[model samples]
Target: MTHSVKPRARAADKRRRLTIEAARVLHEQGVERTTLADIARAADVPVGNVYYYFKTKDELVLAALSEHSAHLDELTGRLDQLPDPRDRLEGLIRAWVDQRDVAARYGCPTGTLAVELDKRADGTLDTEAGTVIRRLLDWTGHQFRALGLPDPEDLAVTLISAYQGMSLLANALRDPDLMARQGDRLLHWLDSLQSPDPTA
Candidate 1:
């Protein structure tokens, strides 16, 4: 029983590693260009082993999508530790700013994946990709609601759209500084949304 458990655990670990590498490769190379061999090489697993874990490229893509979703959850969960909704939102922007270099080179991980998968005629992959962006919109709206905003949902769309637009430009022009500058503007805009102190 102990020996069997060890092999199962190892298999799970290898599967996870493959998914992680797949996400990285897909982000860097785009979905259509990345092959199973690329993912296997990145993960340091045999190409044959990749088949054992994921029968097709689509299956691997699904695993990578799941990885992106989990990463979003982790990021939001970390920011939720902040006491203030404003602070949480600011933290999120800052996090993106920190990744400006990567964004400039490969584009926003979640955003790029969504845009690419959206072109698929099958619709299934695109639907799954849409959920990641939807989750971000919903989470951002929740933060706006916490701040007592009258138009939380609209504000959420505006904020996310701004970020996505900036990300697109940054990647197109290969400018990391653009993301930093836009992040600062976004932080300032968020600050402006707060109600002024009545006592003052």
Candidate 2:
């Protein structure tokens, strides 16, 4: 006899699928254009089921942002495997550079969504949507601090801004090579910041 699946397990599975589908749809279509029905269709769940997991579109947006946050955390953790903070930062830049094609086609997921959410005053996302960039800033700032920069936070902001700017231009121009070139410039800048350690 086949055993029946538990309610909680099924619910968790549905929630996970919803989150994944929401992220995909939100990335492909801006928040204003993506409806719950689109997400439900993508996730293969009943449209009514979306309400059980997310009461409103805003809730699903926040859930998608949370998913992006988790992805950033995982990337940070992977970068941490590098011994040097500078190397970690390079790894971060390289990671973005590697996604140049995707960025060109769809824009940076976090950057695009953050800007979209900020333009709204309907309480759809507010400052909470910006947490994705803030997390990157904080993490990059920490790496800069480890590199002994006096103004690590500012440096972090600059780096993040540069990456965002590159993404914006690349997406607007639909030029993946532009992003890769910018990535090289960022790596060169990072290299310039390096000097012979006084202690060594």
Candidate 3:
């Protein structure tokens, strides 16, 4: 079987690469602290060239947010493919816990970025930033509902709160192990969930 090398789609590839890099820098340094120049340096694109893709800092941040949003959506869809609803929830937990080192060092990517952007003086990007968490909440709620749980929305809020709270403490205390330990506890909690009474 003969094969030929695929050619690069340079513009689209560069935009995608630059967007991912921007998301990384935004998560690590934060939206306010991160500049297009910083993202360009991280993306290895010329600073002047960045303007060709994103005209302003807000535009780049939006691109990063869009990238993050798509990632969360993809993750949720993948989780939904699990044969068991419980497994799906646990998979989501494992996904976040797998990032223990990064979470401990930089905090939860979505949580931190959402909070940072929400607290911005301008408040222009607040709603866009919040969509990340909202998407997670909605997806988690759907999973809980799939498990035949009443109060699925509430349960989803509790689970997300627990994950975000652990990330916050782990980051604040600089304790990377804390996330893993909390993840273990979360797994146990998952095991303990009983399907709520539908009639209640």
Candidate with maximal lDDT: 1
Report lDDT (CA) for all predictions.
Answer: 0.93, 0.91, 0.88
In candidate 2, stretches whose alpha carbon ends up further than 4 angstroms from where it belongs are 1-5, 195-200
Better of 2 and 3 by TM-score: 2
Compose the digit string of candidate 2's lDDT tens values, residues 34-150: 999999999999999999999999899989999989989999999999999999999999999999998998899988998888788875485776878898999999999999877
The lDDT of model 1 is 0.93
Put down candidate 3 lDDT per residue, 1-200, tens digits, no spaces.
Answer: 12322223566677887899999999999887888899999888889989988899989888988998999989888987889989999999999889989999999888898888878799888798788889899989988998988899999999999999999999999998999999999999989989867687
TM-score of each: 0.96, 0.93, 0.91
Candidate 3 wrongly placed segments (more than 4 Å): 1-8, 197-200
Residue 97 accuracy (lDDT) in model 2: 100
lDDT of 1 by residue, 1-200 (tens): 99999999999988999999999999999988999999999998989999999999999989999999999999999999999999999999999899899999988888898888888787678888888899999999999999988789999999999889888899999999999999999999999996545586
Worst 10 residues of 2 by lDDT: 1-10
Q: Order the candidates by TM-score, highest first — what do you get?
A: 1, 2, 3
Ten contiguous residues with the weakest lDDT in model 1: 191-200
State how far residue 184 of model 1 sits from its true place (Å). Answer: 0.4
Model 3 per-residue lDDT at 192: 90
Indicate the residue-level lDDT of 86 in model 2: 96
